[model samples]
Target: MTSHAQSQAIAPKGISRFIPILSIGVLFFIFGFITWLNGALIPFLQMVCELSEMQALFIAFCFYIAYVVMALPMAKILEKTGYQKGMSVGLGIIAIGCVLFVPAALTALFPVFLLAQFVVGSGLTILQTASNPFIVRLGNEESAAARIAFMGLLNKAAGVLAPIVFTTLVLSGLPEVNQELLNTLPEMERAALINDMSVSLIQPYVGMAVALGLLALVFMRLPLPVIEDNTVASVDTLSPASQNTQIWQYPHLVLGAISLFFYVGVEVIAGDTIGLYGSSIGVENATTLTSFTMVAMVLGYALGLLTIPRFVSQQAALLGSAVTGFIVTLGIVFADDSSLLISEILWGWTGIQQLPDTVTLIALLGFANAMVWPAIWPLALKDLGKYTAQGSALLIMGIAGGAILPVVYGGLSGLTGGQLAYMVMLPCYCFIGYYALWGCRKYTW
Candidate 1:
């Protein structure tokens, strides 16, 4: 080939390899933005729709449950078509889901909103199934954790911004609208006024639709590297034949998956429920309360971007994070209300400030949860070879813990008030701690 032609071909091939990573990062961002918005949405929808505490939390349940429902199917689709095509199809699904928001909002139907979230989550499951494994295979097996950590930074960065943007656009104005209606309008007019609040969601979701469409188009044009799995199974590691094997077959991976499941559930409970939690603790302006969690998460991602790979191994990071998570959970549970000791401790040591003790502790969990995914994934899928796709699907399904655990917490809150209910996070962290200490060390099939 001519030198220039060779250069062109080589460049596209190199770019193609990175495209799946990039596209997956974008998909992660979309998921983060959509998923984290629930932090704001639960409270916002609660007021607009006049839902009870438990009822409003169904917002999170409906959205994350799609992972459980769609993960296996997403794996099946990816098996039929490679990751690249599956990613494009996933983005298309998300676009359709985003468009669903328009009609859902117009009708002022809360269930329709939940249904739309389900569709969006379903799309994300497919994208995650395809993208995560692709990113892992992009380089040396040893460095998979580091690469996934980099992706985690991107994912969490989107998560950090999502609540801020959504709250500013859809929720910040709500209190004023509610006040004005209450002061001047009659009872009947209040319903119309509350119904009009749904209109705020229309523009935001329309923007999401446009962005998703453009991304889908870009993914279609990008040339991604085709990875073929060819590793043969031995008694040494997990294989498809291991299906008949005990959950202990891949002890480290299964433990890692369990840790991930619990970590995600706790993280979501922290961010997604903090606004309402703040309200229960007498903090008004739920929209602004989310800034605490968002900022803390941003700081953690910053630390990961700066220190991971070069400065620390993923295992060390995971260990340190689990320790911090346990400490913070304890603080939240046991710290007295009279003293702001936890807040002072976090601010003085970590330089994160201007947050309530409860809120600050929840944000600290973000740091603890930051490296868990990166540390866990490579360990879980280690040496899986040809079964990597199916293994990844199983890991992805663990995300349903995010869906299940929060509902449990929400139900507890309904039964015992939000403050006491936060104790649910303690056992979740305990499971994560167990995984970090010894769960990632399985040396046999």
Candidate 2:
């Protein structure tokens, strides 16, 4: 296609085109807030439930595994309801999950908490299936990464806020709760302290449920514009045999899904496990550590906004991000764990707290991961056309990596300790680099 013709075809006529972007932007913001809260919840529940690191990671597993279990079903629902109503239904489901937190908190039951996480993850599965392609299809194909990056900015910004909000709202006035401290306490006293902390969760979750419910109502009434699938290949041009082909016939899409699996696994490990690692290493305010990763992601998103499609193509960005992620994962494993030198050099001059070199490197993974999703979505969904929903669901299913890998990391950490266990992320980035270089370009089986 000529640049001029592509511009006309890609660009929607007026300000009205931006309305769906604005609406979906709200959903992305919500997605980040709910997703990153797992970081804080991991440490908090570990202490409250008196569980080991491996058990605590089940928090992430239950939550993200829901994406795998629900993605295809949610995609089917979207076909019936279309994107707009599907999004509203997703929001309502998330609200229901938030309500579950109330009962989970009052009972101080870890299983209940896991169930709630699964419910929330299922809701997010629906939103992600609908919205990712929505953003990509909203603009010129070449600049799709830039549009997704803009949504990412909002998403990461909420991620930055989620940990701080959880700390302030949920952990305020709680005694210094750690394994060592709890171990020293009498059994009854430890139980009392945990019960108190568990009750604090009730108010915040109730508020979130109410807020999400209202958003669901707004999305229901909102007249979100339906985007036409202009890129679908016409049946008149396809041979009868070609018309019967399955989604798996596209090698690029299959490879893209596998790439996303590894990408999401490493991403979740970097964002959610940092808190657990920090706490294990004796950071006083470890629950808020996720904000550090989120801040790095926001910065990365800003850089992507400035450079993507204008200064660089999406594939180049994806390759660079994968390379960076691999390097950072090595640093996390081999860097001096006791030294705060890295943090001091990077941002300590601002009077903020300094992290050990290892923690700092893990936070840097957020910067490395920020562009991967934005870049991969455009590249993977490039020519799937009418198969977009099925392809998207396949991609969404890859999010199970987040569910599985952190548990793997938890197990590895148990065996080798936290620092060396990050080696698990190395090959994940390697595969993403492969996809950026070759897999995304392959269309045949």
Give the winner by TM-score.
Answer: 2
Q: Rate the local accuracy (lDDT) of all candidates.
A: 0.74, 0.88
Per residue, candidate 1 scores C-alpha lDDT tens digits across 396-442 of 88888889888899899888876667788878777776776777776
Q: Candidate 2's residue-wise lDDT over 193-305, tens digit each?
A: 99999999999999999999999889988766564443454421453324525788877788989999999999899999999899888876888899999999999999999
Query: Which residues of candidate 2, in runs, are more than 4 Å off?
Result: 1-15, 234-244
Q: In model 2, how large is the Cα lDDT of residue 59?
A: 96
Per-residue lDDT value at 355 in model 1: 50
**What lDDT does model 1 reach?**
0.74
Q: Where is the poorest 10-residue window by lDDT in model 1?
A: 1-10
What are the clash counts of all predictions, listed in order?
0, 0
